[model samples]
Target chain A: MLNFAPTQEQEEIRQLAQSLAMEQVRPQGRSAEQQGDISPALMKTLTQTGLTTPFPEEYGGSGVVEAVTYTLIAEELGFGDGALAMNIIGSLMGPLTVLLAGDKSQQQHYITPFSDASRGHLQRGSLGFAERTGGYYVTEISATIRTEGEQYILNGSKRDVIHGGQSSPRVVLVRLEGTSGTGGLCALMVPLDIAGARVSLDEGKLGLIAAPSAAYTFENAPVSATCMLGQPGGSGVLRAAALYNILRAGVACGTARAALDYAMDYARGRIAFGRPIVSYQGIAFMVAEMAMKLDAARLLTWRAATSWDRGTGCETLVQEGEAAQYQAIKIAKSATIDAIQILGGAGFIQDHPAEMWMRNAAAME
Target chain B: MIDFTLSELQQAARDYAHQVALEEMRPISLECDRTEKIPDSFMWNMQRRFWAGAAGQARTQAQEGEEKQDNILSILSQEEMAWGDAALSTAIPGPGLAAPPILSQGTPEQQAKFLGPYMDGQLHWGALALTEPGIGSDVAGMSTTAVLEGDEWVLNGHKHYITNGARSDLVVTFATIDKSLGREGIRPFVVPRGTPGFVVGRIEEKMGLRASQTAELIFENCRIPKDHLLSGRESSKKAGFKAAMGTLDATRPMVGALAVGIARAAHEKTCQWVQEELPKGFSVYKRREIELELDEMGQELEMARFLVWRAAWMADRRIPNSKEASMCKAYAGGLVMKVTSAGVRISAPGENSESRQFLQKWFRDAKVFDIFEGTAQIQRLVIARRLFPEVDIP
Candidate 1:
């Protein structure tokens, strides 16, 4: 069973995603970043592909909930363009949380609209999980949720909430009242329009410009108790967290792979000392190391995604998922830096995507 | 379909190697480094207890129609053995670098003559001589010369930094017949021990891996029968150089695994140190920093191992793995250096204990992983050439 080959269907899907990435997503990456938003037309094209709606079919999705498939698509979209890929994948955080942890009624109310083909692109969801704290570790969740009669009072500030300003139906991770650590962790789906909730669009970000992020501050924002994603002690929120890490890792792998490809092409064509610079061990080795790191990161990401889809134990899922993200982010940062190095002066100019990628990779970390 | 599970045989190989590393290598690791030699008795014991049995079983399995999983099995065992102590693991008796070329390109007679003794349950070493006094990496520019005179060939050159060269029973030596022909003129001559004028020159004093001897071999009018020429005279003139590269392709992943093993050892040691030595009530921020450092080390090591395994897997399946082989070597080589250096940094402020000493030794040993087999730069060139096949790289 120590095989490295992808299944036939997985390979086919990978190819399809790759084509969309190369032909559609990659081309618009720069413009989308410059504008600080994905074009409406391009978002429509991506939405029609059902890549953004991976919920259960009964909830108006393609029902492709396999983590492996999601990762594969995430990687391809990442390869096409980091900002665009982030924009597309970031939009799914809220709905995926609802689908994973919400009761049936919650899913129908929040997730069903994502499956509506006509208006799905506009029905974005965001996850407010990260806080300005120690790290991305879930045990670091400091946001608080308290039950009051038939409603829940939310009070906390969330940082790095992707699409927080633009998306409705936000799913925020919070610790229950008077509780500490992971034992009291839970998630609640809150509408962005709710009173006492404020969303501030973050500006001057170093990268992922197209997939803009915002910070959210909740001041006693009360919502129906039915909005709770899962039971207080349930495992659904944990699973969703693991899936988010894996998907993000997939995106990093794509970005690293793209950086390597671009660097290789540039090195192959640039002439110096009467030969392509790639012929020199100096340039060639850097490119090679980039390629190696990219592949290594991709394999880790894939393994984590596969383990998730196989319904392996939660420990294995969290460990692999964390490792994958750690490596993917590191490699993405290094690979983009190498890409810029390979491009020389052109790498620093906006005329090339290497600089953009370098920023995006940093943002990913 | 992608999976990371090891088969039963691989698991056994890993466990058995780990046990040997734990019981045998760790005990003598520092002593060997201090003395700059592995005891002959140890080598003999390993030959009889480990290498001979393993090699003999492999032969028997091959004769019994079992598929060869040599590449994967070798890497798995090498990683574990190296995890014990890289120098002692490398110094274990058997054909070290000399097996690949002889097995792949040697004639039946040559194989019988050179490799047959390794199966006799005796302590014997086999070395491959490619590096020389003035050249390294630039294989085509080697000045070692082999000239034919009747049925015998004369070899004259100095090969240094050769692993196991001082004690090798037979050395697969590379020498060019025509200086102007570059790589095409290279020929591999099997020079047996005690051949006239074949001298073991200097035994190097090194920074690390001191248990494994690094010898300088001098061939001053050394003579061997033409029959000892690997692949014989009728084979393609390019075969010798190709075989040299082929051996590198096969061994780089093994070297990568060895590097990973060393990193694993250092990382594990650092982990234990962190658990036991850190003061109670350490600052939360500092603890978080250390935690992130440890996490990075663990992730990087896993990534390096996966790269090594994938390359070995490709080699076992007989896929063209030159690029992947270099990838693992380059990545693991750089990675080991980083991890070992970090290991030393993280474990600092401790008493100069045995564990701390080993950490320092490992840091020293990690450097050569990037320098030998193929330097990180050389591997990159190989990878770049493969990536852009349309553009010729000299």
Candidate 2:
């Protein structure tokens, strides 16, 4: 109803996440950037927020949380550290398949563990969508899915998968051979511990330094029919694309927000050419433009999230989500780049997080 | 305590102002621009509505210590007015730029004698003469001179781009008695427009804001009574230039809000055009892209508005808002140009369309919002200076 005021619960959650970010995630991310290691401490802090729990009431989740709230939460996490936020969202999105489409039995076994703290440490779930070749587009993925009697065989490998080398059940996207439309692409939950699945030596990607990623191969990894989400024969392309876009947009918005806040604080203090550099129209206008794009990205991200929550049709949701993703990527990359520009030579150094954010935004995955 | 939602009362005032802008100002906007002269009746209509918004006990009641929010309401109302016609908003009968410095620096007698003329009966005007041909945004670099002889003061100066300087009942002229003392010796005087030797110089020939007058004022041996001198306290006398700068804390937000309004108008018009007059074969993807663009403009407008509101709120609360004020001015002033330019692109993809001409006019108008009342660069410098108050950068 044309309101910018978040609900009490949303505000509370935002504050909690903000504190976690400022106290834990941001520092952890900055320190971890040097080592290329994901801090288990940051992950534990995230889990403690109860956000990592699957969207099921019976399993101890807040139960079917609103997509808008999730998007807002994702943004706050991003504000803490983009790469770290990406890791958390990617992990959460991995199990989202089972939560949204799996049978009751699968929810109890696979998703309930993350919700029940009594069940020990939070079990990580990895969603692998990118491949070794082509681009980041999920539709253009090269992996193949085949049907054989009571099992499904998945062939081909994925590169740059977040937490890929880690021991977790990975939700892999595959193009079905000899299928049309909705039945074309398929998503399968493959436990990497099984035979015919191999994890490669850690690549420890330079980009998105907060999330440690590696390549993995699947040579005809057999998956039971029960492991498949939705109807035994289902469409995955639009659904996957929509969800991916929503999550990415949220992360991008958060990063842009952080970049703006940092740039403003710096502009206030940084003096150059006998006055504050911010006094220069060229720099001031650029900062203003940065703020404009950042705000735009956030609004688009929120709208996409709202569409995902309230939209009755897949087409509408997909369209909004895709638009959000396109804007988010542009905004994040530009905002971070402009932020670095505002920071000048200091931006290129490791002391400021702008360089790190610029790298993460450049990836735009 | 922190929220972006407007109160019901604020929303109602906004709605009323919005209606007036769309229904009243929008109709005569183009004519006003082309003729370079706003209709007199239209301005009176605006002043009455603005006065009702928060000026006094009219239209609404104010509880003690609770936010009267007159400053905020004034800024928001300016936004609505600008949305209809930016030039018309400037033309609204009031003190224009002269009110701030005079109200702050002028003595009680000087204030009543000078400000009363503009606030009362016949809708007169007052202007501040500060900018010079060689000096822009440099308060201390003014070349005007003032000398005291017996009980009268002789003023000599040239003020360029002075708003309402040609027609105002009084012009607040800033002149230094000693050039060597620079800012310290500078004092403001109430030079009645028709005072001896106070002549109106050339009017600016401009690209946009043509509907509003930009006058060059010349004061050669202009003399005024000693009572006309705005000598306040010793601290204020010492803090002359700084006090004049303080006036911006009250008014920049209004300018910022106006900029946001202009951007919103262009954005709304473009969105309507895209939906109602879709170019042939505008694909679903392209439609979605346009929607995204519209969303971007909306977000930017909202962000700029919040900055304005925050700055205005601080001004009303008497909180020091130099930093906040400058930030708002910088952000809104810069984005309005881009937002309008984007609108021009979408509504007139062919490079020349009727819709493009409308938006192009707005884009031109938006440029002045950034250039005046301390340019965007000047605002940024103010914000930076606050941040680095301790750092004496050479």
Candidate 3:
């Protein structure tokens, strides 16, 4: 049963996403990056597609929560524009975390708002997993959380918190008090407006400008004990983290694909020495390698996503998901660089999407 | 419905190949590399076993009315066989690289004449000779000439770097009838090993995969019946080039699989050394760095395998996969070089055991994966032409 074709419904979803990407998302990429935010209209269109509302049906969602579907949508949106795609797909971090690690009551509380169609586009959820000091490995996280009577006291600073400045609830990984390494890890849902919690929007970034990020400083921020996701020493947080990597890999694949297509088109049209530039092995080979790498990255992402949906063990999920992310990031970086190289002087400027993709690819890495 | 699971038959083939690799190949691997030859007894024994298994599988497929899984089966088994030793794996007695063109482009009579002996459970090899001493990737510019005289075709040329060329029972030789016609005048003829004036010249001494013989074949007034021409027809402008490319497309992924197998072997060996022999006092930070490096290696190997599998799968389904085939070969070619290089670097400052020695051998063997079948650059050219079909790259 080693099949590579998507199911009918998945194909339909792919078509819908691809159309949205080309018709709407791609056109607004430059403007969104310039304005440092996605246009509300485009956001609305994304929301109406029901891609951003993956949760339990009772919690005002389509209730599909399928990793494959999510990845497919992410790739298409990413193809449109990496930053805007992040703006849309990154919104899933918080709600998805709650659905995966939160208790039923927690899921109802945090995920219901996402399904509110009218405000869904504006309802962004953030995941505070990255740290300024630690390596990407879970054991390197230094943030801490402690239980005090009926509340959990959180004390940590998280950098690169996507949508961190927003009012929506967010999930942050923390080391349990007096514990170290992965065994001591916990995920706690923190409402950004809570006491002793401060959120500041990051002013400057190398890329991904359309999806603004914030830094979170929690100094003894108190949260109700019910807000704890899964158990204090459970694998829930690990699963959530792994899923994040897979999703990001999907976006990376999309961005790389975009850069490759754009470069191939340019090479086909741009003539040199009495022939199209693509006729020259110099330029054609670059495009070909880009296409191959992009395909390789996408296939890896898809495999990882499928593994997640099949309820594979947490260890396997983390390994496959992270591997996919690693390759996708590398491909995105190289594909954009090659695309720029193919375009020559014209690629250095903003007239074409190649330069923007290069910057976006860098930021993604 | 994108699934990565192997069918029952493919899995069985893979497992069996792994066993053969471990038992039959690994023991002789180092010695063969040193001596630059695989024992004839070893080749014959392996050949007998291979034909038995192949015949069984063919019968099973025919009985079950299964879709052709030969491509998938070949790659799956190739990876494992190569994991034991890439050189010995190539040295295995079979049709080698000539099967694709004969099966795809040759007339039924030609196929029967050239390929029938491979099924007799005897040691035999078939080769595809395209690269010459002066030309590698520019296949259309080859100077090998084939001129018609009566009912026979006379070929005069030198083809070098031909795997199994010296021992092959038949070599599918490429020659140009008219150099001025460029690719159009090219033709491939089945030149039997004993055909008059078909000479096997010096066997190359290589950095790695030395057990796999590379021969310089000279066709000096070598003549064969006109019917020996694949497809038994006058050369169409695209036929010769297309047939050669078609052969590469079918075989390139299998080559990629061999590279993956070698990389996996090196990576696995390095991992074992690090786990078992590394100094206990190695700093945690340094250990983590090594772990990250290993992680990247594993990821890259997985990516390369996926590419190889997809390409093989596409070929099985009869899908036009020229670009995909090149993609897998190009990616896997570069990937093996990187992984094997890392293997040596990470495994350094450790015991100089036999396994560690093999690591160096693998690093040497890894280079040709990127160089042969199609060099990495040539693969990109093919891929680019596919990507922008309108560009008309020569």
Pairs that collide in candidate 3 are none
lDDT digits (tens) for residues B1-394 of candidate 3 = 8887777777878888898899999899999999997888888778776888664674477357567778888899999999999999988888889888888888888888888888886779888899999999889899999999999999999999999999999998888889999988887788988999899999999998989999999989998998888974344677777788888899999999999999999999888888987777889898889888987878878888999999998998899999899999999999899988887887787778886788999999999999998899889988877777766897
Per-residue accuracy of model 1 over A143-198 as CA lDDT, tens digit each: 88888899988888888778888776778888888876556778787776889888
Best candidate, DockQ: 3
**Candidate 1 local accuracy as lDDT?**
0.85
Off by over 4 Å in 2: A1-37, A45-80, A92-121, A125-206, A212-332, A338-355, B52-65, B102-121, B147-153, B225-238, B274-299, B342-357, B390-394
TM-score for the second chain in candidate 2?
0.92
TM-score of chain A of each: 0.95, 0.90, 0.94
Fnat of each candidate: 0.73, 0.08, 0.76
Which runs in model 3 stand beyond 4 Å of their true positions?
A175-185, A193-195, A232-236, A271-275, B53-55, B62-65, B232-237, B279-287
Candidate scoring better on TM-score of 2 and 3: 3
TM-score of chain A of 1: 0.95
Q: What alpha-carbon RMSD in Å does predicted model 3 have with respect to the real structure?
A: 2.5
Candidate 2 i-RMS: 6.1
**True lDDT of residue A95, candidate 2:** 64
lDDT of 3 at A357: 85
Clashing pairs for model 1 are A285-B380
Q: At residue A114, what lDDT does model 2 achieve?
A: 69
